[model samples]
Target: MKEEVTQNYLEKVKAQIAKLQSFSIVRIPREENIEADYLSKLAIVKEGIIPPNAPIRYLELPSIFALDVQVQAIDYSNSWTGPIVDYITNGTLPDDNVKARQLKI
Candidate 1:
C-alpha cells in the first residue's frame, strides 16, 4: 500500500516536471543519494531542536553521530594540508571558508 502511494506520488511529480519546459529528470543509484539524504536528516534534527514540538526518536542519534564523525574526520584531514594544497592549486583558500567567515560577521 505504501509503495503504491509512493509510486502514485512520484508519477504525479513526474507529470508536473514534464509540464515544465525547462525541467529534466536524472535517476541515480541509492548509494549516490546518501549525501543528499544525510543532509536532509541533519536539517530535520536541527529544526526539531528549534521548534521543540516533534517527537525525537533514538534512531536519529545514530545518523547524527555518523555525520558528526564524518565531519570531524574531514576537518582533521583538511587541517593537515587542505589549505596549502588549495592555495597551491587554486591560488587561494576556497571560497567556502570566506563565505563562512562572512556569515559570522
Candidate 2:
C-alpha cells in the first residue's frame, strides 16, 4: 500500500518534469549553496532548543558486550590454545605456534 502511494508520487513528478519547457537537476554541494548551509545551521539550533511541553524521545543503544564475539561458544579444543591461553591467562606466549592462525586473522 505504501509502495503504491510512493510509485504514484514518483510518476506524477516524472510527468511534471517531462511537461516542463526546460528541466535540469544539478546537485550543488553544501559549501557552494550558502542559503541551504545557513538554513541547515539554523534548523540545528532550533531543534536543540526543545519546547517545555514537547515530548523528547531518547534512543537506548545496545551494549558493546552484546556485540562482542562469543569466545566460549567457539570450539578451541583442537586448534592452537596453549600459547594463546597462556598469553591471555598468564601473560606469556606459547612455545609452539607463536602466531595463532585463525579464520578471523
Candidate 3:
C-alpha cells in the first residue's frame, strides 16, 4: 500500500513537470529552504465555487518583441493615423468622413 501511494505521487509530479517543456528542476534541501517551509504552512482559503472551465493560470514573464515594435512604427504614422488611433485607443468615432468610412470598412 505504501509503495503504491509513493508511485502515485511520483506519477503526479512527473505529469506536472511534463507540462513545463523547458524548465530546470532544482532540488533544494529542507534545511536551506525556509520560504518553502513557511509557504507550506499557509492554508488555502476557498471563498467561492470555482468554474468548471477555470484555467490553471501560471505566472509568465512578458516576451520582448523588437521586430513587432519596429513593424508597428513602420505600419502606422501619427500624422495621418491620429483619428484612427484615437478611435482604437478611446473607442471614439473619428470626426473626419474619410477616416470614419475607412474605419467602418
Off by over 4 Å in 2: 31-105
* Cα-lDDT of candidate 1: 0.56
- RMSD of each candidate relative to the true structure: 17.5, 22.1, 16.6
Show how many residue pairs clash in every candidate, following the order shown. 0, 1, 0
TM-scores of the candidates in the order shown: 0.26, 0.27, 0.28
Error of 1 at 40 (Å): 6.2
Q: For residues 1-105, write the lDDT of model 2, one tens digit per residue.
A: 668766766776786688789988899999898666666666567667643444434447423213434456765546667456656766664444525443114
For candidate 1, write residues 1-105 as lDDT tens digits. 668766766776686688687976588765788655555556677544533333334574333224322233344334746655556656655468774354345
Candidate 3 clashes: the total is 0
Q: List the lowest-lDDT window of 10 residues for candidate 3.
A: 61-70
Q: Ten consecutive residues with minimal summed lDDT in candidate 2?
A: 61-70
Q: What's the alpha carbon RMSD for model 2?
A: 22.1
Q: What is the C-alpha lDDT of each candidate?
A: 0.56, 0.59, 0.60
Give the candidates in order of lDDT, highest first.
Answer: 3, 2, 1
What TM-score quantifies how close candidate 3 is to the native fold?
Answer: 0.28
Q: Rank the candidates by TM-score, best first.
A: 3, 2, 1
Per-residue lDDT over 10-102 for candidate 3, one digit per residue giving the tens place of the 0 to 100 score: 776686689786768799986797655544433242545443443434346322211233234444545677667777887767777887888
- Of 1 and 3, the candidate ranking higher by TM-score: 3
